[model samples]
Target chain A: MSLSVRHILSVNDLTKKDCALILKTAQNMEEISERSVKKVPILRGKTILLCFFEPSTRTRTSFEIAAKRLSADAVNISSVGSSLSKGETLLDTAKNLEAMNPDILVVRHAQSGIPHLLAQAVDCPVINAGDGMHEHPTQALLDLMTILKVKKRIAGLHIAIIGDILHSRVALSNIILLKKMGAKVSLAGPASMIPLGIEQFGVPIFYDIRKVIPSADVIMMLRIQREREADSFFPSLREYSRFFGLNKETMKHAKKDVVILHPGPVNRGVEIAPEIADGEHSLILDQVTNGVAVRMALLYLLCGAKK
Target chain B: MAEQKLLMTEAQMDKAIHAMAEKVIEDGLSEAVLVGIKTRGVPLAHWLARRLAQITRKTPKVGELDINLYRDDLSEVAEQPIIHKTDIPFSVDNSGIILVDDVLYTGRTIRAALDALIDFGRPKFVRLAVLVDRGWRELPIQAEYVGLTIKTKIDEVVKVMLEECDGKNEVLLKEHFSKRT
Candidate 1:
């Protein structure tokens, strides 16, 4: 009942109970979207700052919409137009925003742990929209909400995460969260793209996507982050697409009711086929829709905790 | 330590619900729909719905409302308000609604419920019913149907437990005891 946890920086910071509570609260938040008048007055007097150091369309817009739907004032500050471009430090930028009296600071940065450092520097609450290759906690939470909505449960399910695991914060957050909730998690991709010591996380590593697909209840396809890659992890995107990318052949290996998920800006032919991305099995857009509700729950929970 | 107080027993609460059901008939609300405030109010609403069905031979529509998002004192209540489901399957347009709850305290909850109910649709008229009415009315609100009325200090807690939820049917009063210095 305390709900004293003020920041959502990583899925690693959440317990199983915390996860369940969030899912339940998000279920409540989803009801507001179904109403004719979707806006709520809970956050009418509150101001939220969306500070992004990296470029984004979906996550940023989803957070903005979530804040607006909650009747909170949402202001977007990107690095391209901000003082960070003028050689200002993250602390200085954050301190300045704190001076403006924002109730919540939702941050996305290219460098991991910036949100954490900002949370420590500011008195108000901080929610990690995404921090580098570290974790996208809200993405993971919305993924959970989507899976729970589609499959009705998370425990005792085979959830296969495919593609670019090393560079994907979505993959890492989902892996930790699914494992915590008693799901069987498996990661498969080009061998070079698989992070070392990932086996220590207790999920099986598979080189062949075909081997993991037949047993997977939920197939989560992670986007190939080419911008973040310093060196090529594969011979070519075509070969990687043919072998590991989910296509018609790979779909044959999956279960009849397998739910396919992708944290998007998807490489239509690389990580997932265009058909599967838009098919009945896809929860990609559901994940996007649930993202707003999950974020609304996070903002409501975290900001309400502030003195 | 403060001694515990029992306000109502299971059978007494059942009789009270029947009486409230009869009050609905007396008020010419045979076509009325019941909307429960979330958590405790939900079970009480269903209980009253069943009682009304027996009294009128027609089951009233039932719904659940969660007022967390409409609450004015969410910051004062808890660090984070635990939001639950707000489900009203039937339309509220031009229909009479009897908002049901377990305990009516400061009337702020009823006020919030009123705000939340409006978001669905405009109702012809909305009425209030509660299992208990412990007075500390911060807002100008009063229940039309109340099972029991108890006077108590501000620090005392009133709890209504339904068998559907808490595995019992009883009303309890617990006085808060501050730690000795």
Candidate 2:
């Protein structure tokens, strides 16, 4: 079956059934990695263009790998190397990329709604890799997949999202997806790190990480957005880690079998302690592995639909 | 809408399966690894394994292969092919592998399955087995073991309904007129 929506710009728009379909399909795609020949012929002869205006490591590489594994020709066009550097606007760049006739487009930009904008301008479907601090749907999906493998379920589970919620696209996407799947999500970070109006989303907020830790079945530690470091959400990294960082003491309060998740490039002792990040409870590596599978599923679904 | 005509009754199906089991036994069953193409082929593989066990008192390894990723007409098909797990726990490098399917038509699906199977490992030998071989093949592929041979037109559909998935045991032929026709 195909995805009902044309563009995956945000998790706010996906239904629970949509999420379930994607996760199931991703499980099937995960097997490709274990094969001696890690490639499929499903998307053969199709071209997938990756347009990234922002600097990224995992998301860009993950999408490219997923496309290639499916035997789809993957073309990367970053803002620096492309015509966008030659005085072309984002819209003009998108139109020119469309002229080449790519089957699906994966986009990442510094500003939010860029994928939404390109989806309207292009005939093919658009998958948002990460559009500012608005949402990173694929990251949330891979997190859910990882959690499912360990915890066996998402419904009725307490998930505490710690650190830099105010600027985390991962936290927002996870909150929306977890809520949709009937999971209890709470925010734990410094006061300034918690986004305002998040209470309207019906999730409780905790300034003290310890308070949220006891009931949390899953602890999702978010990276402190260092690029936005000039804002100074906390007094210093030293104070932030002491109060909100997930150390051995924090782990004691958490569920005995609690699973930890982080969406890449973690600031070791800032959002999470080194011991906890690399410890038995951590699924940090699994999240990265699942990212490729989740992307492959989305590409197959979107491209297979009536374009 | 079209009415279905019963091609094989429950007792007739048992006889057809027995014939298939005898053919596998004759073809060398000691090193056999039965791999079912996903959806209907899975149960067909299990049934053959059980029957083979009854005769030779040895149960062969049964595996499931999903050919969705290897389909030749993936982009041209209207609906997206749903992917399923392709789990072959045993080694395929040097074993007699029998590819099982419920109904064989067009021969393209078997061609796709062959492409998917080879990626797992190099098999000692590979053979094709089908419960029904409807003769309208688009490719040169042929099944080594067949339970029943039926002539079919382009507008007809051959459906094998079993208890494990479809809650019945019978073979039916129906006329299905879609946009393709």
Candidate 3:
């Protein structure tokens, strides 16, 4: 099976068939982590370079682990501050990195389109780890994999995405991916935090979290990205939690089996209550595990050719 | 234009498998686990188990392996190779492991399979079985039990279509350029 595009830059870039194939491949990859000999010779003699321009604990490590598990040599290069706002440095950096001749390039940057720019600069395949307020395609794919592992399907499920919609690449990617896969999506957050003209994407936008609760089979919480804000979007974290945060009380209004998802650095009591973050309904840890499998699938699909 | 030849019909394929089962029974290796290579070998392994059970009054163990990750030409394949499930649930140590496949050609696949199998556990011993052995092996490998031996050109391909996988049990020989979907 083949993905529609060689470089997965955005969820909008993938067809529903592409999404299904990725999830299926990720399922096959999940089995490898269970074996005593977790490493495979699949990506042997291949090199994968993970370039992160932002601080990330899970996504970078997951990609590294996935590359290693497939027996590919992974090298990590990151900077504390490499925001794409710097004009020619982005392309210059990309040219220098690709000169290293890695078989594949996995990139995460504070600015959107860095992965796209690098893909064009480099001869190898490029994977978008995450980019500012634009898309996190792999995270969305892993999120879909985790959802399918539990629900067994994505269609017809009501998935309510709450919080930081204005700054979350995860939310945008999830909304696009889920809607394409036949799931009904609802966006909920403070009016200031929910970006204007996003209803053009056609999902219902709600200011009151209670209105989205009853029918929501899955509640995806987005971290309020303070780093990207020059001026605070919302007045206070306390006020945001009081309204949109998912806790035990909010659980009552949702479907009895409603699952919770957070693209983490969970603000603890801010976006989601700690109990629910660690609860049975949480697919958080599973999402982290599936992240590795999904990255493996992507690397195989893009870079697994010998020629 | 490329040519196609019907090498074995459904009945002929069954009879061939039956003969191979007889060989395994004659060798008293029917108790060994039948571990099939991916795609077609899986069904052949199950078929061998059924015949072994019918003749010996006890079913043998069965497992499936997908050797995509173990292939030497990972970079040579045109399209990306999708990794399939390699589920060998039983312990391979101290148990006889009979590697099964549909056709044995270059023998490189068997070399990869041996590497894949050893990673699971050390088998007491290992053996190979195949439905067809088309000559022109690129590696120093041979099958212990072969149903058919056909001398062929390098450009010809042998395909085994089984009932479970392709809705038929037949073998076809085709010029490699036309390929088989």
Candidate 4:
């Protein structure tokens, strides 16, 4: 079957069939990750370029490793200490890199839609790592993969996304994805942190975290992105933790078999209690492991066309 | 329209698979494992493994290899090729592996499969087994155990249907028909 879709700009860009295809391909990639050799010659001689206009350790490193594991040469270009710091425009930077003839460009930017912009400018396949508050397609895909591994299916499960929805690309992407796959999604966090008109997505919205957790099959604890929020979205971190934080007390309200997910670098004790984050229910680390495989699937599918 | 010609009935296909299994057993490949290249090869591998078990009373290990990533025509074939899972649960190191497939033709798929299989581990020795060996080899690859041989034009398609996947067991050859003026 031909890969009809070219770029992974947003989760919404993919159909349900595309999502199923990706998840299935990711399972194959996971097998490779488990192998002792842990490398494939599929993408031999291909060049993968990672362009992070924003600072990121996990997403960037995962994409780099995914490329390397597939036998592709990976080159990283960050805004800091790069020619961008010397007053080069984003388009100019991307165009110069395109001159180098990379097979795929994986980009993460602070401003939204930069990945889409670069994809439009470049000839190679462009992947959105995380683009501002717009969407993090790969992150959402990885999250879905992890959930599928834990829950066995995405449909008919209640997934509650808690925290920093106003500034979270993960929340937005996951909301679109999980709903498309037939999961019932609910958003819970401080009212100030929840974006207006988000209820139009059709899932129930709750300001009380305790009220939402009891029925949730999965609870995704998002990092309280204080850096992104100019004014305090809540009164303080302590109050936010008191109401929205997933602590042992709040944990009792969740289902016994409920799986806990955190798109990390988690602010321990702020968004989630250390006990809960490190608890048996937590698949945070599994999410990290699945991220590499999911990215590998994306890179393999997209880069094959480029070759 | 391409007209399909039935080459092997359900019972005949079963007999061919049984014969191929008997060949492997008679060759004394007790430590041999069967790895099927994905889609049709997967079911053929499992069926052959079962036949081998029935003959020798010992089941050989079975694995699957998806060569979509290793295909040379990947860029030319489709904008996006559906990737199937390659699951080799056991170690292939130092073990004899019989690569199973439904039909062998241009040998490109076998070459891709070989490239993919070697990446997992270096097998002691590798052999190819197929239900039908269709002519027109584009590469030096050849199947060691063949149930039957068929001559066909380059444009014709050979399809293998298995009860496990396709709800039928048969091989059909469809002759490609160019649009008539």
- Per-candidate TM equals 0.93, 0.97, 0.93, 0.93
lDDT by residue (tens digit), candidate 2, A222-289: 89888977238778889888898889987888888899999979898887889999999999999999
Ten residues in sequence with the least summed lDDT for candidate 1 chain A: A1-10
* Weakest 10 consecutive residues of candidate 2 chain A by summed lDDT: A228-237
Worst 10 residues of 3 chain A by lDDT: A79-88
Specify the CAPRI tier of model 4. medium
Docking class of 1: medium
Better of 3 and 4 by DockQ: 3
Q: Candidate 2, residue A138: CA error in Å?
A: 0.7
Candidate 4 global lDDT? 0.88
Clashes of each: 0, 0, 4, 2
True contacts kept of each: 0.93, 0.85, 0.72, 0.70
lDDT of 3 at B3: 76
Candidate 4 chain A minimal-lDDT segment of 10 residues: A226-235
The candidates' DockQ values read 0.67, 0.80, 0.62, 0.54
Tens digit of per-residue lDDT, candidate 3, span B33-126: 9899998999999988887788889988899998988888856666776678888979998999899999998999899999988888899999
Better of 1 and 3 by lDDT: 1
What local lDDT score does residue A23 receive in model 1, on the 0 to 100 scale? 80
Better of 2 and 4 by lDDT: 2
Model 3 stretches with alpha carbons more than 4 Å out: A81-88, A229-231, A304-307, B1-4, B175-177
TM-score quality measure for candidate 4: 0.93
Model 4 RMSD in Å is 2.8
